[model samples]
Target: MTAPEPAEPPAAEPGVTAAEPAAAGPDSAARPGAEPAEPTDADAASHSAALPGADLDGADLDGADLDGADLDGAEPAGALPTERAAAGVPGKRGRRRVAPAPEPAPVLDDAELRGALEAILLVVDEPVSELTLAQVLEQPAERIGPALDRIAAGYTAAGHGFELRRAAGGWRLYTRPEYATYVERFVLDGQSVRLTQAALETLAVIAYKQPVTRSRISAIRGVNCDGVIRTLVSRGLVEECGTEADSGAFLYRTTTLFLEKLGLNSVADLPPLAPFLPDDVEELADATR
Candidate 1:
């Protein structure tokens, strides 16, 4: 087999002419039309190859190579590029610019809200009130009320051992009646304080209708409640005040300790209640009369 011959260079395009060879490179010896070097230190002492377009402003060569060609006059290709000024063609004035930071989205995730509520509930040694919760969450008190009710309902529906209840004017976590023994083990030092039926009824009435007069309580309950009121007063759950303006009877009200036991911070934290009046027509007629 014959060895292949090296191919000849192609002719330049018709309208274009070839460039004169740069004087700075060793390739000057091989080029057909080489330029003479200027009388300078580079021309007199050194033989170097000149690169076309290497003198462009802001060009960098540290990241590139000139392959032993002349680089002294070059702005290297690796040089940092200049930021272009906004044009009103130089010094005429340009648009004022601002860099904006990325904004986060505003959305309340259900799981996140539930977690926050649960965490708040756990941290409170007593019942957490909706008003206080509203303040903490930076939401309206009305909004907090519905959220508390939903949470309360969820706990009940899930058959959770702990129940959510309102007492002193706040919300509180409590053990169910069936689990009172275990709860009592943690709460009571040794013995439980037993409450009487009369005491319970009186406390319930006072809790439901507070700042009420003794006569009004007597009227509703259909019994003299002086002894029960005394018991409640002694227990620190109820307190007495000046006579009602309408009937001139002593006014009775529940106390802060009542709130503490109920796990409330205020009366507003109590669950919404049904009408306290009897539903029967006879009872309503008798009461009216």
Candidate 2:
């Protein structure tokens, strides 16, 4: 029998090229019928790995019309909350930024120190400690202490109407005792100088019997003195001392303001009450009997 020659492939169109068949494996091509080999890691990855334009997060982009992601390696405008935390937000970069401390004030000369201390003293409502003054003025504690002493000494030497005094563990400005009459007249502004009689009595009781309970004070006075005691306390004349051991009542005592008002060094300076009492002790005893 004569052998027939194989027919050639059909001609491609003018602009259209013929599609090429996929190259089969060498063994598969050699064998008449063979199953194809399984896809490799590289082949599986190529399916996802080389998408037209893909991001590190595995999200893709087809064109400019693609939605909700930055083309460059930047955070998208609409990011998930979990992603926003690390999305280059200013001042929230997962690290603390501590502001630098303010610089200390320049050291002051003697005249400058005195002026500064006087300025602070004028504005102060209560006694300010030396440590506080040193911190505020940025001077050494030793220097501040001696400077304060010198300032006090200068006031005393000059016989100024006001003196720098240390009391209650701190320094304060005070009107000298001799000049207090003028200061009182100025501050009173037509108000009376005397404390109320009840207040005076409560104060006297507290001064004489220091750390006495309110009940004991009432017992001695034969009246309810809660209001008077409160008034004395409000006036800074009396303050709470330790509570009574047995009764557990808050005990009252005189204050620094009280001593200052009376110009006394301590409660011991309070005059003896017996000397000021009425002289007819025998008649009073006879009447009581």
Candidate 3:
């Protein structure tokens, strides 16, 4: 068996060149007389609109008017005033301007301050604290102390019927010691008026152990002192200071009236409790002092 001869090459049609390839379709690259079609503005715009952030290096965009383009997702150049303020942006006109707080009143001179202090003192029935005076006078406590000392000295030098005295952790005016006899005669008027023994004892305990509670006073006296304490309070001898920290009970202290009656300038001037106490209990007086 012999191999069939290779099939004869297809015959070239008439009027067709043999060296040229077959005619290509309209979409083919090698078609004769075919120039790549230049994209129109409409086509370019449609392509750009389809792909976001697409490169358009060779695209002709001159006739592609973007006036009607949808740019809803684009960031604006500046934020609105309310938005800027909410975001706390610096150097923005939307920021609030806060007005400064008012300053306190100016301090008065020594003479004015003294006069103001005297006016307040004259009206107050109870002894006034240095701190209270300072607050009302709008001056420092240090300055108030000096002014008070000056006032006290002036009263003493002038031999006023009343003297400024510090007592019960405060300052108050009291009749001079020399005038006490006359005051007592006028007030008593031959009436037999005196504190009971129990009241006297309760007052002594309060004078020594100030800021003591009724419960503690009862324990010290070995008897319930509630009645006696009430009597002393009514007589203007003892007064409630504040509550105790641990026990939360009302604490009492002696008043200026107690000092005047005892002829004592302050609680510190009271005679030593050690001498009157038993030998074994004398050491406890040191704690009270």
Best by TM-score: 2
Better-scoring candidate (TM-score), 1 or 3: 3
Using TM-score as the measure, what is the rank order of every candidate, best first? Answer: 2, 3, 1
User: Residue pairs in steric clash, candidate 3?
Assistant: none
lDDT by residue (50-145, candidate 3, tens digit) is: 988887868687887666454543334577756644665533233344648999879899889889878887887877789998887677889888
The all-Cα superposition gives candidate 1 an RMSD in Å to the true structure of 19.1
- Model 3 / residue 145 / CA error / Å: 0.3
Q: How many clashing residue pairs, candidate 2?
A: 0
Could you give me the TM-score of model 2 versus the true structure?
0.52
Better of 1 and 2 by TM-score: 2
Clashes of each: 22, 0, 0
Per-residue lDDT over 1-289 for candidate 1, one digit per residue giving the tens place of the 0 to 100 score:
9999999999878755555444447544535564443456655334333544434345565767545544333443444323223321221123234448877534445666666777788878765678788678765567666666788899999999997766666776777878977878888879768778888888878877888987778877789989989989999889986778876878888888887876666777777655654568678767677
TM-score of 1: 0.41
Q: Which candidate, 1 or 3, has the higher lDDT? A: 3
Alpha-carbon lDDT, every model: 0.70, 0.79, 0.80
lDDT against true structure, model 2 = 0.79
Q: How much is 227 displaced in model 3, in angstroms?
A: 4.6
